[model samples]
Target: MNTFITLAIVLIALSFVYTWGAAASRRVASQTGEKLHSRPPYYGLYLVLWCAIPAAIIFIVYSLITPTIETVIIQSYFPQEVLNDAAELANQTRQVESIAGGFGMFGEPAPYQVQAAAALKNVEWIGKMALVALIAVAAVAGTLVARTRISPEFRARNRIETAIEMLLITCSAIAVLTTVGIVLSVLGEAVRFFTFVNPIDFFLGTSWNPRFSTTGHGGQGDFGLLPLLWGTLMITIIAMIVAVPIGLMAAVYLSEYAGPKFRFVAKPMLEVLAGIPTIVYGIFAAFTVGPFLSTMGDAVGLDINATSAFTAGIVMGIMIIPFVSSLSDDIISQVPQSLRDGSYGLGATRSETIRRVILPAALPGIVGAFLLAVSRAIGETMIVVLAAGNSPVLTANPFEAVSTVTVTIVNQLTGDTDFASPQSLVAFALGLTLFVITLCLNVVAIYIVRKYREQYE
Candidate 1:
């Protein structure tokens, strides 16, 4: 419903943009003998952006904050008798919402409804109507204003170009803001988790049993970080061991050695590996690769479980191959042709040229690719959930069962889990840690890519 309303608003705003641009063009044509500076479409885009961008931002902000505001308002609706009791406060607010909802506040009618239902309906209606009206008005005003400014002497082309540049920068800023928002949300939940579990105990302790209870009993929770870290590192290292060499060789062959036809066929075929979903990879790892490894281990007189870290890591590595290969290929291709020619002119073989020259030139990019691949392998959930045993144990053996942070999070948050409980809160803490690690890796990737660009350019 919200999506449909947003789309409708955008369409209406677009109509206004067109109207504004046409009016401006007509005015300009009347004012001057010369043709308009640019096409009508560009003028329309300028007006549309002016009307739509600020409105879009407001809509997004309102959508995010509305839930929190509603929660506070509903809490305020509860009588003081309910409010004084911390335990009752949550339940009573829920009951109030249930009563309001039953009265057709959000859906169909039921029994006991109140003024809250009407209030909610009013709020929803006001939000949609206001947004649409504001966008339309802004669009009309922008069109008229731009048209008034348009004349033979006016630099419409320059103005339009500058506006587009600002829009692009705004888009980039939105992406960055979105990332920051995610991190902030994770941090907020993690802070809540830390309130129950001591930060030191959460970080350093070996045991990770998050079972907080209201029953003031002998058993408290143990939110440790070490065992999960060990498991994550081991699995990630095993995955990198499998992925790095194969992905690099595939990239090298495709980018430099293969003929055009071979490259065309092989590149997409190799990328087909990436197109296969992670869940499919998980099932394959659990049912197929696990058994195959067990059989091989049995013949070799090594004890290995069906659901082992090695199995999960190997499957994850296969999933990450395209990431490494694709990035490496781009970097390798970016290496100047003159360098390879110089190497060949110095009597270097193709293999020697690639080994000594091309690889060196693309080292930063290759490192960046490897870092990205590692981050991916670290964050992979399904493969580990299926094949890597969910035993958060600190072990060095690849053939042994282990679990990663993502698997632990999935386990804790699955099915009907209490959100306020320590178990669910732990998931947020793990998520924050995961986000931090990935952010660091991304920073490194950007730095490496920039350094590589500087070196080559």
Candidate 2:
């Protein structure tokens, strides 16, 4: 039987056993004229917990160790010549397992490999049977022990609650540990990258040319930050210029001026922009906006690349409009009606009241929305990759093709480059730099919001 199906059957049988145990305990209590410490259901739950938890733990441990044990056993059967090198042994082991599993072989298998494949099938079958048998024995033993403990004085509720609390704590710790692991892994790789490329040159040099070398030494590349940084900032500035004013104005109209019916219809329609995938925006920018801008620039006696910073920035700005609009709208709507009313009492016009009273009250949240949109624009890859002509150049002109740090990272890590090479390692360093920049932006946003809240309150 399938292992999962077997597990399900075990759980179902345990449930019935627990039900019978709880019913028998209640009957015994009635006969003895004694009240149970906890309810009948608590006794059933406690029995189920005991029957399932230990058996599940044993099954999990066996499953995790089985693959390594099987690989070792199979390796022992291989010819000494095949097992001379550790890497070759691992590759051959994988090939044998694949053949056993009925996958296509890379080449004709040797006599020993064929024998090992057959043995692998047998070992796997035996392991599964052993696992099922052990789990069944554990479940039966736990059920009997738990039934004996389910007397009048047993504190079933406390035990169940403690188990649940520990489970929750374990889940929370896993999440925190996973995040820490990712950050540390990236940080370690970035340190290795910095060791090859001088920190000053990487940060301050103006060019970015990663000349990859097969031989693991550092490449003959500029490895500069200024060009990519300038490109990223330039695109982000253009995007903000396009997004902030328009999105804020839309938010103002929806919150203060638009009627209820119009607001309801328009709000959701506007937010639909955020749901479209970034790749779709990239396509639109590459095919439509970039060409149009290039043509328009020629007509106006200006030089513009078909794929340029201006094209990517404008499309990215349009893509982030919903983020800005939705957040700013909610913040503007949250400003107290009393503020508007007080402004009206001071003989201010509706526009004047919104400008002088409501906007000031919502300024902190609006700033936060703008920062979020800016961050989104900075992290965007597909839009910039498709539209921004991937040229790493230090330039002030938005009409020229340029590349950002994210694009450079993608380029560096694209193929089968060795991780030890500076070309590949530089991607991690770029990633770390981006992380730090975003972190600082968040800190500044938090500080500003807190200061504004203090004054407003």
User: For every model shown, what is its TM-score relative to the native structure?
Assistant: 0.79, 0.85
Residue lDDT tens for model 2, 349-394: 9999988788888989999999999899999999999999999999
> Which candidate number would show the highest lDDT if scored against the true structure?
2
Q: Cα deviation in Å at residue 308, candidate 1?
A: 0.6
Model 2 residue 160 CA deviation in Å: 4.8
Candidate 1 lDDT over residue span 48-123, tens digit each: 6666666666667778987776667666555667679998777655655666455323554323225544565566
All candidates' lDDT scores? Answer: 0.81, 0.89
Q: How well does model 1 score by local distance difference test?
A: 0.81
Q: Any runs in candidate 1 off by more than 4 Å, and if so which?
A: 1-31, 34-42, 47-138, 212-218, 439-457
Q: Which residue runs does candidate 2 get wrong by more than 4 Å? A: 1-52, 139-164, 212-219, 259-261, 333-353
